[model samples]
Target: MNFINGPCGYFNMIVITSRSSSIPIVFRRQLSALTTLPLTLSQTNKNGQKHDPPSKINSPPPLGRLRASVVSPESTHFVDSYLTHSFFSDELKISAKNGFLSRGRQLHAHIVKLGYYNVLALQNQLLHVYVKCKVYYDACRLFDEMLVRNVVTWNTLICGAAHCGRSFKSNLNLGFCYFKRMLSEMVGPDCVTFTSLLHTCIELYDIEIGRQVHCFIMKFGLCRDCFVSSALVDLYAKFGLVGDARRIFDNILDRDLVSWNVMVYCYALNCLVRDAFGLFNLMRLEGIKEDDFTCTNLLNSAAIYGSCELGRQIHGLVIKLSFDLDVAVSSALVDMYAKNELIVDARKTFDGMLSRNVISWTTMIVGYGRVGDGKEAIKLIREMFRGDTGPDELTLASVLRSCGNSSSITEISQVHAYAMKDGFDAILSTANSLINAYSKSGNITMALDCFSSIANPDLVSWTSMIGAYAFNGLSIEGIELFERMLAYNMMPDPVAFLGVLSACSHGGLVYEGLHYFSLMTKIYHITPTIEHYTCLIDLLGRAGLLDEAFNLLTSMPVEPGPDVLGAFIGACKVHGNAGLAKWAAEKLFALEPSNPVNYTLMSNIYASEGCWLDVARIRKMMRDRCIYKVPGCSWTEIAGEVHTFVSSDKSHPRASEVYALSELLVRSMEEEDYVPNEDFTFDHV
Candidate 1:
């Protein structure tokens, strides 16, 4: 056998033999050649006898015989002694890197048997191996057993505790405990220690503790450390303190790539789009190469602002930089396009990804949902299951939202059943979406049932259930639910107030509506938005309090939006107040000049007041502007299929039959002395 040195001091041995040799002869020759090597002379056999070097054998044996002989106790001992101490440490590190925990443990035992376990350097190496293998308990045990500890040893254990993949809160607490213990023992922490603690704080979202760590870093004069500074930036950014993060980032005199990336991400996370882009430009100008992290952050910022143009530009840059194939970058791109309503581009990016995780799949499904393509979103869900990637809670929530938007009750029920079977129905977000889906589908009972099923509902659950009741005309139930939410110590957000206000409006509870509106602002400290004002105006108008509604609209602290004015105008038309309607319509026209609904509403009001000239003038204005009213349409679901009918529509496949049945029903009604109201007939128009 011939031995050759390999990388990292491991040996690579090769053996050659005559092709015609018998197995027995090859085995004998291999044993003879092994005995002649310098390594075998120091070997101790199982019987505690030493093997003498053979004199007669000079040639190497065949490979098979050599391998078999090396497994013997004496030969194994010989090889262990042949390796140097540094070489042995390297081998252990290789084993750890390969995730061979069993091999690492065996090597550790060998080190102990060789009486090298007391060596501080070797023990630290073993500790690192244990940490890398995620055998944190073993690492801690070894750490406790060490008679002498150094800064590296303490840092290793502390950092390992932080990254042990246990519950984040528990792991972070453990890390802090170890840190305090290190300090008590007079082991001053270095930059690495502070960096690890900052990371733990980031994960725990304990900004107070993070601030303490920051103060310590500054006291120790370690604030200039690039890695430590970047971690601080990340910590504050995650806590939504972007201004503080920027201050730290700006103080870094020797900023590294990580510092630049983190500051850009901080700005992006806080939705400071212009600032993020500005920092990105500055980074490029400073000649820092942008990585996948940079592109992902910028793409996410673009998604928030719905800036498709900026997103497309970034997409081009991503492709130019060859980052389009990266999973994180690609996922962000898909999300950006989806949020901007560019479903086609989003799908294209999704399909082009070489690999897909749950996030990528969820992003595409959400994009389809946002565009009101519920069918496509559900199709992706099935495809995801078939591909062996089971949908998670987020995936289910997004699909539920899509179904709600499209009013696809059948799909929603299917998804709900799947969620129940898969045990995701109990997840808070998924359950909240279920309430929304049921409510948007007009299934108020199911919405309430879902709400009741929640053992401890969150604010979203209460808001969604309340909205369902309000939208379905169960204003009393909605109002009661709001009170129940308050009783549970859950403060109502603007959305919750909106639901209750809408409910009061629909139920003709004008005083209740006004009271909630005031309560939302004064007690809850939530400023009333245009949506709230619209609800209040609609409530008063429905109750024939048009003047009060108008006064409230005009007295809004902020300028009323088109929705508020439109609601007021709608109220005037409902009460047949031509002067108020004309005044509100002029405001609506100025705000939304191209809206055909406003023109039609004004015309209807004038016609109801027998003002033919004003009605003709409004019609002429609509024609001159080429504005046309959207045809009123309604749909009904039957046998899991939706059938739609538009006003004066004769294009249905069964239109003639439907018309004949309608005529027969009218004739029968006349025979029964049924009186028909003619106020809304074409003759009035």
Candidate 2:
């Protein structure tokens, strides 16, 4: 190019500089061979996977006539070199976009062979490609070899290091190091630099560094930049500093959609539904259209706080904005309705979804399970399998829970089989749910097997195993496991304590139960819940320590709830204490006036005492109050089908046969001299 005398020759004219003192010159003869290296521009990858190229590059005119018509040969050479640089730059961008690391390396070699390695812009773009492809080693090497650099060069490396996949702590540290080096070189950071750094702080969960970034933004007078302001809002919100995030959000001069969405998300994330709604309204007032992120965050917040009314209002807005078609927004709607216990509404939303992802299917299944509709959950899973999106581990776990709630052993086993077949049984969450499901299904042996299969169980595994043992009546084993968990340095939470307390109550280990209760409160500092108190009272009541149980009930830190009083009443009935039984029954009746079980319990107590008058009065009170006993029901699985039987019911198609078999069994029992204990029989309520 005539020794850099042309218009754009200043780039080649500048002296080279680098991290090291000098750049070693390689012989042109040795490098010329690389220029002939064949470059493949095929759409197929080395692994035989086909992918579209990033974009098409425009071809330049042929050089044959161009060299002949040029005013001078040197000018033609300059134009030829410019075309080559442009071509290679576009190709490098394509490789970066598609993550074609091997192709990018080849292009780099070709660029060096063409003697354009010192072109600052070309070098910067190549660095970007390296960073984009996640080849940080090569990126750093090229950066160190570069004789000239700019802000883009540092920002590329910093942003890439900040956002690298896995092993992020070290990469984030490297990013911070790069930032320091950039400052040492007297290069001031721009808004993008601060934005990336703030994001990095959030990933590191270092609020101190986040605050320092915020200060730096202000110091650099870039705080008003919408990008920087939005980043600050996100950083503070992540650290739970809602006030700080709102402050930064309020100060934005030219607020964009991103800033508004960030502010709304901040409120939603902090569980401030009112603020989130208020900000959303303000956005509308400012003529800012709400997008999918805004709706998704608000709906999720409403779901978390159980604000069904607010969630519905948000749903209306979503429909008004025609965002119901968005998969994320629709999934949030389903989640909102399901968590609020409005299963019908949840189902309607789920059925109307135009496109459903794995999340949508999982949310609907979880909702059905939460509301005790195990069969519906199972049906939905089957439907999901029929569709494109298969159930994930969460879907399996939730459906397993539903089966457990309904006590459908057959369904539970079916789901477990599915999990095993699909490799979900090894997942920690699914495995834990399987343990609980088996325990509820009265298959303690299977539950133990599931627990044992976990190679490295987490806290949830231990808690689930302990609860399984406690629920299945293996109280001693549950207690031993709790101790073993503690010996392994697993700190017990409130749920773990509940499992151990339940074990103590079931085993009738009064002293041990009381000791563990004390340990939980004093050592673990866990506040006792109603379930904990119920277990303690039941333990004392089961052992006939009525006086002590009653005193504990009265002196409970929190008010004795229905469960506590009910436990005491059962204890009184067991020991034949008519006086105290009457007192507890009266308290329970007032607390749960509509509950037929409480009235029935009191009526049975009076009848057991031979107080016919009191029994008649109790029955009359029940009738006047329109109270009736809920039918007792049980179910069993036979040949992969479930059969349910309810007391005094003849609704089944085979009712006649079932009643006849029951009568024959009763006669057989009578012939064997079996005398049924009729303790306070219930004729009618």
Candidate 3:
């Protein structure tokens, strides 16, 4: 008789099947090892039957050149246990890699008996075993029982906790507590401790804690430590601090590719696209061979900058290096093309991917979602499932996102049900997507239900709930929700503050928006991004506080971009504040002398006040510069076909029928005294 105890360490558990004459679809362990209590390996078979000779397996060579104080006979004995432990650990890791989990567990039990009962070493290795085998409860139980707890012990358990997918906060806290205790014990942290903490902080977005760690390193004069230093650069980059991260990168004397990649990747993330290009060029001059990761980051930067020229150059580089088939690199290429608004090019890139993974599928779904191709996004999700892969939160979130913009409440609800069924409804992202979808679909009850149920809601979740309330005309509720968010220990992020500020602007809470804007940098430490400025400008402008809004635009520490300038000019036009309108117009016209919208926005201000001559002058200037609005196009997809209609497009299949229908609709609207909002029309047209 034979039995499999399975990966969970329970014995004699019924697997509910027998008839062993045929080859077992799931094989059980046939061998094991015996232990010599004082910490040594003696191999055997599962039924206590001896098999492999324990003495035949050679121990790993002794640690060479390690500090002498930490090495001795006892250490050699410990190292022996570590080696046997490593053997079992390697087996478990291999099993997980090959999806043969039960076999790995049997091997683990065999190794355990071979002199590795030290709570410290065993706890560490057992934590790793449970993590690799993905048995979270067992891992936590082992972590709890350990008499000795060091940073590594805490790190292994914390990392294991995070790996299980949803219990990050518990592990995140454990990592922090262990680190703090280690420091209090004067254990003197190394690079690994800082890296692990920074990783959790990045997830937590605990900037205050991250900065505290940064300050501690600086105080200890360990900022020059390569690993800790590299992690700091990465952390700063994550929180939108590219300049500082770059400065740190430049200061590192013994930097590696990881260090350089951290800075370059962060550079791309902050839309410092040209800087990313410059850094890449500098790396080339330094003779640092661009690896697949380098090319991937370069592609991501290129995509975000919307520079087709750079993207094509990188495409050539990938082909030159024959690295185009690399999945990570290919995924970045796909993401870049999609973000650049080149769906055809993105499709070409996707089709060229010889090996596709979840990242590849998710990127394409996001591309389709961005362009409002709901059915395509849904079809892609189905395709991924058909291949026997489960949809992760990212997959469901992307599809739910498409439904959000399409106003497809029914589809969103179905996706919501599926997400709940797949155990993703508890994840913040999937829950946030569900909230957004329900809100956009006008199911406020359902939207609020998802929001209220999210325990320990992050900034994104809080912001989503507030935004939903504000979007649906419940401004008071939105403001109150934001206040509640502030009451929590968690600090609101820039995006969250922006939502609340916009709510205040809508609700005529001028004093409140102004207060929050000031507190944003000083207290919360979120530097005022351009969007934040735009929100403030709009807030002031809406209140007919044109002068104040104008002052904000001019006095901005950062140079105002076209969007910022346009918002100010639009507000000036509304308030009939010609002084600022003229001020904004000059900047707008010079921004792109050939931009049709700028010319039109200004001309409308003139035409609205019965200034026909000015409108004509603007039109003549447009013609002179060869500037015209791109033809007005409206596209609706039906049955997977995109049907595009222009205001007077005669080239479509149903052009005549559409024209007749428009005429009839216009007549009906005229009878009801409905005035067409001519905002879509250009005077020149």
Candidate 4:
């Protein structure tokens, strides 16, 4: 098609003079061989009648397409000739569709083969192209080839290094060196240059350098610049300076949506859910339009809050805004709702998705698991495998955790086999999850076996396996794991110490627990956390060392937190130490006034001691405080539906049938003189 300016010659074409502007003269000669039709044209009708060309059409007067033609990949000569221009580079822009990288790379290779040497521009683009291809070596070679490198040249190298995950010390230094040179040589770095530099700083955890960069930009009057402002927000956010990041973001002269989203994401990632939501509300009040990224951030924040109500509200807004169809946003919504135990909402969202990625499928599966739908979790995995999608390390790990509840050792092994085949067995998170799964599944040995297979376990991995042993009632094994961890010279974090202390508590190894507790502080300088104290109380309580437990709580340097107080109260209950239990209850109530569990535990303690008046008083306190014990519910997924079972709730779809069967089973057990264990489980009457 011949494309030209309008008759008035007042319009410029969007990009090309014609779609075939990149075609060169020599490339057109070969097209004649492909088709038998002679090159020809038709005349346009002007005003009334069609005008005839003089027997023949004059040759086109341009270097573009001489004749219409089709070329295949095998026609290397044609491709080389055709690619000697900047056509595909423009199309690689963000406005183009998803496969720009693929098409752009093919054209780039062809362009290089044509040997049209503009050494400077070519070297600059070559560095970027090689980086895009993840060919870091070639990128470096091309970067070094430039006799006179410009600012773009240096920025390209740094960006390429950062993009390719070449966090190698030298590469990281070179990126910084280039940034420094830009300042020293006075190349006048732009917004892109500073943002890239900040990313490198964050990756390297050079918070000091990041701060300096921020100040530098501010002094130069670039603080109001959106790109600089956003980069600073992200950098400070990453380094745990949420307040500073938020301040910089707030001070931006013109806060665009991207700026808002970046700041909001920073808040959410730092676990400041309230602040995130508050900022989101601010955005809405300011009449800022929310997009998929915005929805994703808000929903993700709500999910982290573990607030079902808030998550549902965001999900509703997404539907209202028609952003529910966005795969990333919808997947985030699913995760949020799932974690909130709104399985129905999560499943509905997942089902409504027009397309789903592996992350989407896995998020739903994890949501099911969080709601205790182990069967549904496994079912989803099976379905994913049956369909086109397959499980990643995270999916495998989550499903293994689902199997933990059933103690499905056989199924766990099967998953392990699958992991081995898919080469996902090497990921650290997967390994840790598998260890926890095995431990919970009543195979402490297998859990240990799994831990041993991780060639080198980080602190988290080691702590996980050690905690696994302690969790599964094998305190001796847990202690041994801790000892082994110490032998490897892996500095145990506070969590690791808690696991070891709890192990000692379980094994009645009071002396060992005390020794490690001391070593944890004196040798490792690790401060004892509330959880560590809880483990000590549990240890002493379980071993009937009631007075020592009371003494431990009283001797704490700081005021006891809820978990610590709760632990002491639980121990007092176990040992029938009424006075200590009363003190523990009072501390717990004062610390966590809204905790129904504390009130209920106090009432139960009074009831056990047959103190009727005290029980009455406890109940009165509960009533005055408006505290009521929420009935616990458990859900299991089967046949694509989550079956929720709750005490005193007759709303399960199979409630009538399940209740009748439960009654029958209870009757049979009663006839056999079986007594219900009301102490451990409050769910059943």
Candidate 5:
């Protein structure tokens, strides 16, 4: 029998043919010399018969490298044994790389028989192989039994434990314990040790521990270590301490490409666009070429700053550097264009990408949703499903948002079913978005069901459910839900408070609205924003307190914005306070001169008060300014199709039928003594 040596170890005995009989002799001799095993090339086949080797077998070189030694026999023997162990280690690594765990175990057994099991270097190699195979338990067991250990041994286990992605808290403690033990053993932790520990802190967001590690590095005068310093920069930057990150970066005596890239990323993450660009320019001046990381970070900053001009420049640079093909850089570019309201450009970038991941798809969906293009966004969702990139929580949430904007109830229900089927209904973000969608679609019962489905609703969930109640005119229930939220020890954020205030305003609970407004600022320490003030003004105005609402608007710390002024004008029209109506209208017109609603509001108020001359003057001003009232439009969904009708519109395909039916209904109502209110009709001169 002839045996061929596999890459990892020697094969067992097999029959050798006459043509290949010579190769086994030399190969066996080399194996025997290396492993100290006697050569036996004969074996029985599975059928209990001897098998002959192939007729045309090629002879290969020896499996292991052996060095000549001029030392004593004992020294030469040790060198050869070490070289044999190294050969086995390399073979085991190759097995691990190929994911042949069974072959790796076999190689491990061979190393033990060669009397190198206790060798520190070989043990570390085995540990690495086990880690590569994701058999961390076995690696830990081996680590516990090793009588001899070195820094490399501990570093391997520490780094592996930190990156194993299992029982993070336990592994983190284990890694830290190993570091502490290394210190007690006087093994002297190196740059690799600190970098691993710092990374763990980064993942855990344990800033205090990371700070201590930074101090330790400084104490040991290892501050100049580029890798350690770069990790320190990352640690600080992640914690939002960009100043400290920059300080550490500046202190690095010898900065590498990683250090520069990290600092640039740090600046970008903090939204310091000018500083990031300045440092990037400095990096270029230093002759350091830009890579994908640099471009991605700069593009993210451009997105945050909403600078499409800067983003275009970066996009040009990306194409110049041929980095546009990089998925990460391309995703960043898509996000930048989407945020800047350049949806066409965003679509162009997304379409040009050769490959896209989940994030890339989600970004485009969100872009379309933001522009209220519900049809386009839903189409993309279907395309995503066809392409096998199933929608995740973010994708579903964005699609729900689009459905809400378009008031597409059918689409909302379909997406909600998909969420339940995909088990994403349990996620808080999806649940909140579902509540918002159902509420906007005028299905309060379904919205309530979605709210009740959450296992442990967070603040956002509470706020969304409360808003659903408020929006659907269930003000009492909305207030009760807010109280329930407080009873559960849930702190109300600005949005939650806004929901309750809106509920109070809608319910006409002036005292409750005023009380909560005070409580929000005094008890919760939440600062009132323009939305809150607008709600308050509307509440006062709705209760026939136009003067009080106007006074509140004037007393606001900040200048009354368009929404606030618009709310005040609406109150004037409601209460027939034409004097205050004119004042609010002037401000609204100045703020939004082209908005026809302001002119319409003023003309309606004058006509209501029988001021025909004032109404004519307002009409003339609108005509001179070329502003026309935007016709009021209402839509209804029938059989999953939306039918929209503008006031006095005659453009529908079945307009004559609709108008005839309307005329018939009105005549029937008049015959039944239904009196039409003529007070709201505008009289033309």
Candidate 6:
């Protein structure tokens, strides 16, 4: 039989399958050598026939690379084995590139059957294919079987362990241990090895390990490498060490685009808007082109500073560079306009986009919500559902916030149902938003149910539930839950303590409130903010301890803000403490001269004590200052639409019908002998 129909079917398989026209000329010549050579087999075939080997077989002339290994007496056979091994290695690389694990395994099986399994080069190639396909366990097994390994062998496993998409800590530890083994084996690392390890440190937020890696790079003089220095910059930037990051970035002898982007991102991450803008100007002077990432950071910085004019300039630059079509840059533009309260401009950009991701849709939805346009926000959400991209957890949370602001109970319920169907309810942010939405919709029971659904309630979870109870006036339940959270070893944060203190203030738990305050300050070492002091003062004043409340206010380290004084004034009105009420009202008036609520509360306090002259004086002061109490606005959702009503507003379409219904409710209240407090009317004085 000819070699094409040879007894060794494995060589024929390799020649037929991998002999593509696109393969290089050198490989094609080697493949031709395999088929044209007259082969002989020493082993017996399945038919129990042993073929005789040729004694004077000549080596192929084009196989000079592997010709050095042909020094053995069986030169032709050895050349065949080397050529086959080389072809298999190249094919394995292609398999790895395409992530074809099955094809890779078949090639591996062929290698083992041909008795080339112990070849170091072939084993390393197989290990690489497994790692590329993410079959890490099989890669580890193959690695353990190899008796001899090179630096490539150790580097493959190290990089694979770092990026296997497992637990962050576990992956970092695994990569670190592999590096230790590599060092113990006297295998020095290259630039690629250190770069991967630094990336793992960045992911794990282990800055200490990153520092150690930096030391190693310095010692090995690899700090001059572009990629290694860029990684070090990213590592320091993530930890907010801007000075260190800049030092490394400046030391880079050959600064590439990635190095410049890292430094710009570091400034942006730290909110140094002027510094970031300055660098962008320098980069433009250097004539280095900016990509979508660079523009996105600059847009974010402008949005944070509320520099709408600067954002417009950047928007012009985006169009000039044709980056306006990029989804990330377009999304940043929309966010900039939305945050500056230019909703119309934001809408124009959203409408002009050719394609959009979930972030694009969510940014537009949140923009409408920010401007109190919940109808438009809800409409976009429906349109998003009809498209290819659906809402993520953040999208759901933003819509939930809009619904809560409008008190749209029906919409909140619909979203909660959708969350359950789409498996987003388990996300902590979505779950917390659900709790707050239900609480704001006046459905405390539903909020409690949502809170109980969390499998692992984090700190935000417990705090949301506590605030829900406080908002609904279920203070006892809120306190019990707070205690339960403490029992579960969930350390209460400042916001958590604020929630429980508000609960105590509403429920009149003076002793418990003082104890918790002491616990927060003494045991937890949390400094009390103005809100905490306000809650404590309100709690004391409500129980008729006006002097004690004033004492605490005076003893506070920080000056009292408007909210603190307002709460104290409300408590004073409840207890008829006009003397202390006047002192606080004067301080509040000085602090906020334009706020009409402070003057109203002070006038009401005087009217209740029957001091008509003082009330008239306060009214005259308001009139002279052109101060008018802003009308309170309330909204109710009806049939999936929100209707807003200001106090005594006559602009509603059905104003006559609303007035008639209001009169009917008032007459019924009168029939039941309900009394109205005349002193409360002085708030409108």
Best-fitting candidate, measured by TM-score?
6
Q: Candidate 1, residues 1-685: lDDT per residue as tens digits?
A: 3332322332323323334432111132233232222333333334334344444233333323333443443443233223334444666677767877887787687566444555666677788888778787898899999988888998887787677654546656878998989989989999889988988887776899999999999999988888889989999999999989989998999998889999999988899999999999999999999999999999999998789988999999999999988999999999999898888989988999999999999999989988888889999999998996789999999999998887788888999999999989888899999999999889988888888889889899999899999988999999999999999999899999999999999999988998998899889899888888889988998898998988997898988888887777777777778788778888888888877777877787777789999999988887776456667677766666656798778988989998999999999999999998643433221
Question: Tens digits of per-residue lDDT for model 3 on 445-537?
Answer: 999999988886888999999988867867788888988988886678888888888788777678888998998989878899998998888
Each model's number of backbone clashes?
A: 1, 1, 2, 0, 6, 0
Question: For all the candidates, what are their Cα RMSDs to the real structure?
Answer: 9.8, 8.6, 11.4, 9.6, 9.7, 9.1
Clash pairs of candidate 2?
17-147
lDDT by candidate, in order shown: 0.80, 0.82, 0.74, 0.73, 0.81, 0.82
Model 5 per-residue lDDT tens digits across residues 110-170: 6665445666666777887876676777888988888878788889877876775644667
Q: Which scores greater on lDDT, model 3 or model 5?
A: 5
**What is candidate 6's lDDT per residue for 112-133, written digit by digit as tens?**
6455566677788899899888
Task: Kindly report which residue pairs in candidate 1 clash with one another.
Answer: 1-60
* Candidate 1 off by > 4 Å: 1-213, 235-247, 270-275, 518-526, 616-632, 661-685
- Residue runs of model 3 more than 4 Å from their true location after superposition: 1-116, 119-123, 127-291, 304-310, 370-375, 403-414, 437-457, 472-494, 500-580, 631-645, 649-685
Looking at model 3, the pairs that clash are 39-115, 40-115
Per-residue lDDT of candidate 2, residues 1-685 (tens digit): 1132222334463222223423212233333222211122323333334343355346633333223333432222122343455566667778878988887777777667556778777788888888888888899999999988889889999998878854458888778899999999999898878888987887788999888878888999998889899999999998889999989988999999999999988988888988888888999999998898899988988988899999999899999989999999999999999999999999999999989999999999999988888889989988888888878898899899999988888888888899999999999999999999999988999999999999888889999999998888899999999999999999899999999999989889999999999999998898999899999999999999999998898898898878888889888888899898888888887888888777788888888888989988888778777546677778887776667888777998889999999999999999999988776355455
Report how far off residue 495 is in candidate 5 (Å).
Answer: 2.1
Query: Candidate 6 at residue 45, lDDT?
Result: 43
Q: Which ten-residue region of model 4 has the weakest summed lDDT? A: 8-17
Q: Alpha-carbon error at 381 in model 4, in Å?
A: 1.8
